[model samples]
Target: MKPYKNKINRIRSFALALIFIGFVVMYFGIFFKQYPLVMVIFMVLGLLCIIASTVVYFWIGMLSTKAVQVVCPNCGKATKMLGRVDMCGHCREPLTLDPELEGKEFDESYNRKKPAQSGE
Candidate 1:
């Protein structure tokens, strides 16, 4: 079985990872102390990563406001959900707002817009 996580949580994790990567990159810059230009470049790149992470965090905040808050049937905890299918943050229970999708296997692709199909 595929391990699934709340969409918001996944994005948040990505943002957190970016921050760590930024710090790691900056730490490497310290090793190039003998070459001023190279050290400067590394520092700049690291700063950029941090900035990008900050942007991603801000985006997550915006998405949070748009997501639906519902109590998970399995976990009995309030969880935020986005798109057609989402998992409970607390228990990893699959959730969906669409009645048609109820009882069906969870598929993330359902959230994406599908192109019109022509008759075969």
Candidate 2:
């Protein structure tokens, strides 16, 4: 089975990674101190990454407001879920808001809009 994580947690992880990457990029810039232009370029790129991460963090706050808060049946813990299918943040148990999807295998594709069926 594919590894599944809570939507919010996944996005948060991405943001954290971006911050780490930004620091790493900036650290690399120190190595190019001999060349002022190259060092400046690296610093700018690093700053952009940090800025992007801040934007993503803000976006997460917006998404959190839209996420549904529910008690996980498997873990018995309150968790926020986004989209049609999400996993429990604590236990990684698959969750769904749609009755039709219950008992079916967990698939992230279910969150995507389906193409219209053509009449054969």
Candidate 3:
């Protein structure tokens, strides 16, 4: 079975990675300092990455505020849930808001809208 992480955490992780990547790219720009044009290009690209990271961070912050907060039964810690099916942020326990999905095998697909089944 594939391991699942809370959506909010995953997005935050991605944003953190972007910040690191931006710094690394900026460092690489130093190597081309002898060529002013090349160095400028690298610096600009790196700056753009950092700017994008800032946007992502801002977006995630806004998104987090809107996510539903629930106290995890498994860990007894308060965590945020994004969709109908999400893992507990503290314990990786599967959580669901829908009664029908409760006690059933955890599936991320449950959060997605299903297409109508057509009968021939």
Candidate 4:
């Protein structure tokens, strides 16, 4: 099966990983302390990663506002859905907003086109 994840959860995980990578990069900067310029470069790069992560977090906040909240039938919990096809946050069950797409293959592409052009 194609690997699918709750969109919000996946984005959250990505933000978390970015933070970790930022720290790791910053730590590596210490090794270049002998070369002050190199150390500064590493530090700047690391800081940029962290700042990018913060931006991504802000983006999530924006996306959250646009996400639809639904109760997952599989897990019976409130979850957020982005686009048309998304997996349940709690149970990873595929869910869709379009009736015609339900019970059919789950494809992220389903969310990309206008319903009128999707050929149903």
Candidate 5:
């Protein structure tokens, strides 16, 4: 089976990982204290990672407002879905907005087609 993840949950995990990465980079800067230039670079890179993560978190907040809240049929728990398809955050069950795609295997490719290019 293809590996897929709930979009929101995946994004949240990415943000969390970014914060950890930022801290790790900053920690590594300590070892370059003798070369102030290298230390500054590491510190700046770490700060940028942290800032980028903050932006991603804010983006998620905005996306949440537009996401569809549905009760997953598989897990019977509420979860948010983005675009035309998403997986259940709790059970990883595939969910779709388009009736035609119903029962189809969950593929991220379904979300990438441009409507105009497809002549839709």
Candidate 6:
């Protein structure tokens, strides 16, 4: 199974990646100094990536405010969760709001509209 990360943290990581990518693209553009047009294009694209990251960061910041804050039982630290199932940000422990899901194997489908079933 794929590793799970809190939605907020995952989104934040993506935004961080965008920042890195933007800087790398801009740096690579420096190699094309002789071709001003190409260099400018790369610079502009990189700037757009940075701008997109900023927007994503702003959006996630708002979404974070609306997330449910709960103390992790395993780690005893406060963390935010967006859906019914998510991992603890501090300890990576699986957590769920539904009592039925407690102690069950962590499954992303638990957050879906339809109830998760044992048999697929």
TM-score of each: 0.94, 0.93, 0.90, 0.90, 0.90, 0.91
Candidate 5: how large is its RMSD? 3.2
Can you tell me which runs of candidate 3 are displaced by over 4 Å? Answer: 115-120
Which has the better TM-score: candidate 4, or candidate 6? Answer: 6
lDDT of 2 by residue, 1-120 (tens): 889899999999999999999999998999999999999999999999999999999999899998999999987999999989999999999999999999998888889899335483
Instruction: List ranges where model 6 is wrong by over 4 Å.
Output: 114-120
| lDDT, candidate 3, 1-120, per-residue tens | 999999989988888888888888888889998898888888888888889888988998999999999999998999999888999998999998889888998888777788335483
The weakest ten consecutive residues by lDDT in model 4 span 111-120
Q: In candidate 5, how many Å is residue 7 off? A: 0.4
- For model 1, the run of ten residues with the poorest summed lDDT: 111-120
Local error of candidate 2 at residue 10 (angstroms): 0.5
TM-score of 6: 0.91
Candidate 5's residue-wise lDDT over 44-120, tens digit each?
A: 99999999999999999999999999999998999999988889999999999899889886777678775324344
lDDT tens digits by residue: candidate 1, 40-104: 99999999999999999999999999999999999899999999899999999999999998999
> Per-residue lDDT for 58 in model 5?
99
Query: Model 4, residue 89: what's the lDDT?
Result: 90
lDDT of 4: 0.88
- List the lowest-lDDT window of 10 residues for candidate 6: 111-120
Q: Candidate 5, overall lDDT?
A: 0.91
Q: What ranges in model 5 sit over 4 Å off?
A: 114-120
